[model samples]
Target: MGGYVRATPMAVQADEGVPPSTSLPDIGAASFGAGDVTVETVHLPDDRVQITNTAAYPWRVHCSLHVTAADNSEWIGTGWFIGPHTLITAGHVVCIKHSGVPGRDGWVRSIRVMPGRNGATLPYGSVTSTNFWSVKGWFESGDQNYDYGAIIIPTELGSNTGWFGFGNWSDAELLSTVGNISGYPGDKPAGTQWYAARGISSVNALKVHYDIDTAGGQSGSAVYRVLNGNRYGFAVHAYGGATTNSGTRITRQVYDNFVAWKA
Candidate 1:
């Protein structure tokens, strides 16, 4: 259900709250209307560009996540580093719900993180982590408003790969923002990254909607902006639809969670 999800930690196995994956991980988000959750909407002309150089600064900081769900199912999502060992993503990426299956709603078994990965090439190697974190709003109840999380990796890869700084923004401030999203999408060659940028389409108390082009594997990718030469993420990419794509907005509470979780 997510990454840009923070799995900067590797999971050893499915944990007590592991969730099952019945389809694409995107099933765990919210939309403006009752749209199909699994479909990845792209505007005409497909403005997303494939990121070729995996060793660059910010591009290198973004990671591709391969998750093994509690039911032994495999799913792909994206994540970006925020600290030496902390990576952020969508909550459903760590704990899933409403899969309509028995005994499949819980924490994932494992997640393999590959940073700055090009197709068939892993620039910074990889890490498999079991350590995951989410809030009660998501785990105890499948609340879309709280659908974001993190992963803690054993290694301090972010020191080398570096990371993005995220912050909370007021809706008024966001109205004038142009956001960026880049991640490995499942529709392309595996492990490949794609990039897009556009003015934010809309913003709410809990979500930020954009017209940026994205696909399934991009869930949990950072919805960020370059302010004063540094990357500041304001949302965690989550849902997609015919009208727009969205991410969990970095509200004050969500920002505090990142500060507390980042290490």
Candidate 2:
């Protein structure tokens, strides 16, 4: 399956509702650093830069979600800080499968956000969340396009560590520019972060496809680009494959939900 693995038994339910659309100002440049890149490649490594200490990529987060069912098992995913208290992730990360229905059960019991998580060490401690948000389309029908979601913590972690701005870019721009993804992969020791870089392989209306090497725990990781010294996440990674991985593209709906959650 392209989706994440459950640590224990779980159930699915409908999401409360989609975030109501609102009028929020764009946090970063509308089209900053797009069309400035020309080179493209398939799969690339992070050039051995230590992501935990890199100043340019400060908002990467390690997420641990506790399923609130009988088994009380825990599953891991990756997320990124988009606001002082808001972190973005994949909806499936916070949702459970329906018993006999087609969609999700509801939000996970709780989530822990650890920004700048190194191996076996939490550089910024961790914040737990009871508040979670995802589009109704995802929970209602498991639409891959709307599989993105958010976490609202109680503290201002982004203030100290900074957060990634988000944007929507054209397929031409995304394919030409270099993209970066760093997250906790299940194949490694739990909570250990890994990094990868590559030009996007393809782009569809709802997903950004890339050759980045990602494992189960990396679902919900940020698929971002550093443009003009600013890192803007454009997708929430969810599906993994042997040759290609994909993320829910930050479409207008996804972008608006993110803004509403931040508000």
Candidate 3:
């Protein structure tokens, strides 16, 4: 089970609802095919998205990255800026190379992240990086349980752009009750699959979980719980469990480390 396995692409079923919010592009109609599996956008009149999807108020850093396959083709996942130059992602979305392999180092390249992206094809604000950090101990040894990593953006994301802060690990219940997952699902194509899912705090609270279905491409999405009906990212996409495939969960340890990283 420890051996490298083919990655599964993250996918959300097509939503046939009224459509998405006016703020976001009509991703459901513009991209995904028709099916019974339609994802309701953040703007649903009845659905309350204090933690996960809709914009309760303003916004902050927008995280972005390129997912390259062995064939050289690539897809992208979007994350928000958690710290200055530090963006979090699901470990599986971005590949990890263990030590002792010649020319096989674990890091991210050709990476670009933009803060505060709008409906435009490109980012309204963008930042790129040359260095990244994973859980130091887990990277050295393959540990799926701690599947999280950080990208060191050389540029400053700057204040007033909605840089994020971490929640105290002591309150896991706050995370469990309300939360949401946002990311670019790879199956839909660039600038086409951005979406959000309503989430509930996972049983452990260390990780965030929800009924929002996802596929392989959506691995490293930011999982946040509601604080006063506002979304604050607590975990980066690590992986989903074997049993409950409804959505992916992000662990607390991975999130805590990234929040504490400096320089």
Error of 2 at 100 (Å): 6.9
**Backbone clashes, candidate 2:** 6
Q: For candidate 3, write residues 1-263 as lDDT tens digits.
A: 11222222233223222211223222121112232223222222323222222122233454435433233334455556665556666553345444233443344333455444333333335544545555534455545455565655555664435565555444456434545555554444343335454545354533444545444444566666657755566655544333332222344454446655534
The most accurate candidate by lDDT is: 1
Q: What TM-score, computed on C-alpha atoms, does each candidate reach?
A: 0.87, 0.75, 0.62
**Residue by residue across 125-197, what tens digits does model 1's lDDT show?**
7777888988777777767778888988878988989999999878888879899999877777777889999
**Residue 93 displacement (Å), model 3:** 4.5
What's model 3's overall lDDT?
0.44
Misplaced by over 4 Å in model 1 are 1-35
Ranking by TM-score: 1, 2, 3
The 10-residue segment with the lowest total lDDT in model 3: 24-33
- Is candidate 1 or 3 superior in lDDT? 1
